[model samples]
Target: MKKNLLVFFCLISVQIIVSQIRNVDGSLGRIPRRGSDSIPDNEISVKLSGKTKYTDYKIISHKNDTTIIDTTLTIQKEYKFNFLRKDNFELLEFHNQGQTFTNLGYDFTNISPFPDIGFRAKMFNYFHIEDVNYYQVPTPTTEIMYRTGMEQGQVLDALFTTNFSKRFNVALAYKGIRSLGKYRRSLASTGNFRVSFRYETPKGQYTIKGHAANQDFFHQENGGLTPTALEAFINDDPNFNSNRARMDVNLSNAESTLDAKRLYFEHTFKLLSSKDSVTQKDFSNLKLGHSFTRDSKFFRFNQGAPTTGVFGEVITSSGIDDKTAYIAYNNELFLDFNSKYVLGKFRVKTMLSNYRYGYENLQNSTVGITKNKLKGNAVSLGADWNGRIGNFHINASGMLTPGSGRLSGNSFKGEAFYKKDSVFTIKSNVEISNRFPNFNFLLHQSSYDAYNWENNFVQEGTRTLGGSIASKWGDASIALTNISNYTYFDENSKPVQFSGDVNYLKLKVSKEFSVGKFALDNTVMYQKVANGDSVFRVPEIVTRNTLYYTDEWFKGNPLLVQIGTTFKYFTKYKANAYDPLLAEFRLQNETEIGYPTVDVFFNARVRRTRIYFKADNISSFVLKKNYFSAPNYPYRDFVIRFGLVWNWFI
Candidate 1:
């Protein structure tokens, strides 16, 4: 009977798992200042002071040019000037001797034909129509800064200021790049637009964003495995490529402080083909959260909502497979001063939720079907406090959940913050989390076409510790960061072997300097990544640098240039090869693609509105990483975004 009921729900879950895409115009956040037009220098003039002529004014002819002019006028007063070109001596700058000008009082320097560069800059910061172009260095996270804006990678992918009407803030962008002897990239084209707006509907802060993009592309990979290896492989699929109609939309409300009704939804759909053996996955859920307190000091806090976590990948499962769906009701409650909260400045939060999980391989024949109908319940309670004084802040918390059957464990976290000066801040933390096994982890099955085998999901626990130091100097800055984590796998009840963990350390610094009318920025980052298991995706050592220059030397019309590069060195994988049970070794001279390697990269962005150009993988240094024992590949050559961007905001 239990197996029969589980089979029924698994059949119905397929309908909810269908793939869907949503609008993306508002995927990024609000447009910021540090706007492209900001001048690094502190001095500039911006004001309108030209001759005010009145025809047939109450005339007073001062004898010659020697008459001292001392004048003051009201709204209806008039003034006039009449002189011949030859006899008219150029007038010097007119000064507003009394009433101050706009913010940061305008400086009135006595000079001829007011300094052009200094003149426009004075008001540049106050003007409308600000945009950003984003371009950046490639890292594991794939996050690039907008260069033309305050950051990198922002130049070519420009977004504009708020639409004066307040309905939506929108902009247009184009991204492109080049590499090796060949240059290919997907352009933002004309439909690349992002918009965000807010309204007061008596509910909460209302926000909506829309993004539309239609990008064309090329083959994803060019090279192939050796002929002998290819022959031995059973299933060899072609590279994956497609022009997707990608759109993402987000809406939420958090307007009034007195209101606690918030709703958020985000969807990503692809207008693509299942030819690459695509398996559709639908991601959807809703939540309602609120906060309550007594005497303005939060004692008990709770929020309840319907949430979901899913894994949907596109693969040819014989019929229609590769989808895992989780639908659960989640609730969290916390207490700052509990029943004898234990410590002063204490706080606690606990979470309990029930979920129905389902996984199915589309082509279910015999070995294709596996199902588990289960429920997950977790409770987490934590507390924190600090001894505030000179420059020290310390706190800590612990949480635990003993699940049904074989699922149970406890976890904890501790954190601290120390500041010695205005320029420096130090942050540190330690975390340990235990995840109990469920139906999906223990009863799910999928065919591994890439490796010609079968794989199953399992339970695991993770522990992490790390922190960073942020320091600033002038407009330039620096940061030192470090993080390490370890993971343990579970078989039936107890732990078995160490799965994998990663550690990374980095030092990053950057500065902006101006040469003539051009602005330039230089930044460099050095990072080291280490993996305990043979699951190698992170790099041993990677260095990245970016240079940016802008041509706003003259007002309005400007030119921008950004260049970036990355260097990496990898260590051979090494395990206790001598120990038979725990054997692992770094690939050597005659190994596969996962062997130790070196790579370099170069990317650039240059633009001026509707017209722009760029290059990615300028050097074509194929920096790649190996992910698993079957010798999986993590490769990056270059991806470029370029073309025309047409947008106007009113």
Candidate 2:
């Protein structure tokens, strides 16, 4: 125990010294001019200095120039390790990206202020920097857009678990699915099964697990139409697309673990089949290979002051047949301490890691964020302080990473809440931080997305900070926000000159109540963008109410009905002509748009049988939009949906 504590402090001290001795300066990024002229830095990529690591890299070029630079930055490093030796860490692991690399690129057009279910969650709005692409032609003014941003998908899943003894249990599961939804070329059709058995012992548990899945992506062209910016080009160009690279994988893992009152040890092994045959060329954006990894860890007590642990994981990738090029091994070491009293009011936990990124596909975007621009590797060290007083809780953390030629910046965020009464409450938060570009924008020089008809490219917008507040009294609630507020630089070395700052503010209020047996809820909101524009967009105001009544006379059954509609307003400019590099000063009046949608449902039960019928978008609203959602197409009109759900298993 004493030796463990001594090592913990030693590692912390060494980390502090290394952080101080680091040599670096703020990195300079690039922002292209709005119009046709290209203003690239001496180095193709100005944002990443020559000394950054553990991030994506890129060639910040323009429609007219494509130059290579000395360094690209690795701004963000996150390692999610499993606490147990047999645990392997991965989020939504082993996802099948379909038949192409479309899932490998930037997908920004989805945030067109349109009510999209899939695009909202990937949280695409977090990054918006420069634009890069090939212009087939321009676009023309349209009277209306139709059936915009449509997607389809289907999946099947099953599971089973059993325990033969007090110390042993076996579990198995299988999944099958197919989908042409979400991002471009972002489709999937896959099948996979896994089985694991664990045994508990006095000292620890012994376990073995294995699994494999295969996925194929569809390469469909002329599948849709796209919209453009130029009036001349809009009429002359056809929005056609092709698939680039194909991706597939076979994966399996094994691990052993030991757990005791004072010590813990674990070891893990993982293998992935990454080599894919390139029979077709959608574009020369991606190359496939094989990746193998091993991870291990240990945790011990140090005189009982606190728990201390050390961990490491390494990975290697190789080309199957052609050794023209491959990936090298990368590793990281983590040091941890807990329950350590710091500053009298806080308990501190610190960690540090060094690792390299695996390979990824790139994109071909001419006017938006992409993954091709992000690529690099580096060491990461962070500290988390926990503090509490009465009903108040506070925390603070920061990181300084060096990648390419620049020192990637850090961020600080915190939140608080209070309750004044049983029915009233108040909450607020002050968060300031920088968000790096998406994975595709910084790494992998190959195609990432393809199904949607977009080529892959790099994204280079970083540095974002903001805050928000909310309060509730009686049956009413109000909120104020400045979610995206900051001055940003592009991948170039120059500052972006906008008509104004990239700042926005919002105000909202809502009330919840019920009339007799019907419960009702309501809300409304308004926002003002920094560009002197007031737009009503996204997750808009709506009211929903459910009427309930007991029909005990009908075999102890109940009758319930739900009705709801959402109202929202916003506007997007569809210029007779537009420059992908610049935004023309030609503005349009606010469009008082109305999306009155409704949902109705019925539920009934009789003994062991229960039934449900639901209807959505009863108004049959078709999609409408002016942005280049796919390639040169816009969503138009309203649509409707109806379905029945049955519960057969509990």
* Tens-digit lDDT string for candidate 2 (252-364): 11111111111111222221112225643221111121112222111111111111111111111221110001221223222222221232122122223222322233222
Clashes of each: 46, 104
What lDDT tens digits, residue by residue, belong to model 1 across residues 499-585?
A: 454444444454545566333333444444454424322222222233333333345434333332222222332311110000111
Give the whole-model CA lDDT for all candidates, comma-separated. 0.27, 0.26
Instruction: Give model 1 RMSD, 1 decimal.
Output: 25.1
All candidates: TM-score: 0.42, 0.42
Model 1 weakest lDDT span, ten residues long? 251-260
Error of 2 at 157 (Å): 6.0
